[model samples]
Target: MTLPLFPLNTVLFPGCRLDLQIFEARYVDMIGRCMKTDSGFGVVAIVEGDEVGSAPGEFARTGCEARIRDWQQRPNGMLGIRVEGGRRFRVSSAQVQPDQLTVAEVEWLDDQPEKPLTVEHDDLATLLGALSLHPMVASLEMGGEVKGQQDLACQLAYLLPFGLAQKQVLLEMDDPTVRLARIQVLLEQLQGDLTA
Candidate 1:
């Protein structure tokens, strides 16, 4: 299916939330149309270039669908919106519009069936909870809660300050179990780095 794409430097995971400060005319119009039709826009991670001005040179093929949850006009006269990550998708083709919005034809990805969080997930859960207390995270409805393997994985993946490449790997992973295992390794690596 074809989707209006918003390329950003950040990665958003399913079930997580992201806040956007949109001032560009292309995006403002895109968001308005999405809200009007009660649809969603695809958010891709920018692999090169910047979020503002012209098109980013490259973006991850895998991305998330951002559903508008709340929106308001900021004091600075820009649009501030909160969006919830819904489905995952892979962009097969992309086209840039005259206004600079990148539109893509994408294929939706399915999440593995829910898997309950286990003992192995405890440490990650603790870390996720702590991050949720940050003002930016707390302001949103998500980036918290370790309800299941999928939730824990997605939430943690989105919350961690991992660089774009690592984030893209997590987004491309379809198996919650494998993703959880990888996260476990990353968390340990992070812990080791901190202690050393």
Candidate 2:
């Protein structure tokens, strides 16, 4: 499928959630078009660039396909959109389209590994559960039971006060188990620091 591409230095994975403010003229049109269509768009991790709109050929080949979960029109005529990460795909090629939007020909990836969560595998859960109660973290824990470790990881990865570098690490790691383990370590360190 032809996808409107949003390239950023950060990566997005399936079963994750992303919040984006559409301020660029090109993206405003892209969002409108996606809203019109049945299926939405894609976001690739920009590997070499600094951030969004820096340059092309700088993004990673694989990215998550996203659909608009929710959105509202902002006062500035842009969109405040919440994207729920769907499947991962590889960009075959990209072309600059008519409305300054980038259209990418993508090949989708389907490898959903459902490993049941274990207490031994998820030491992060205890800290995340506690942190989820904090006023600063409550917004992220919305809409679900606390038992989902995948959701917990995604929420904490997005909501935790970590730098982009740390998030990029989580994003680039293709193995979900490894990512969770790393996040566990990071959370432990963070908790220790906070208590110290």
Best by lDDT: 1
**Residues 1-196, candidate 1, lDDT per residue (tens digit)?**
9999999999989999888999999999999999999999999999889999998999888999999999999999999999999999999999999998999999999888898988877877888888888987888856455669899889888888777888899989999889988888887888899999
Off by over 4 Å in 1: none
Candidate 1 residue pairs in backbone clash: none
Candidate 2 local lDDT, 129-155, one digit each (tens) = 666677644543342444455565665
Please report how far candidate 1 places residue 49 from its true position, in Å: 0.9
Number of backbone-clashing residue pairs for each candidate, in the order shown: 0, 0
Clash count, predicted structure 2:
0
TM-score of each: 0.95, 0.75
- Which lDDT value does model 2 have at 109? 68
lDDT of 1 at 185: 83
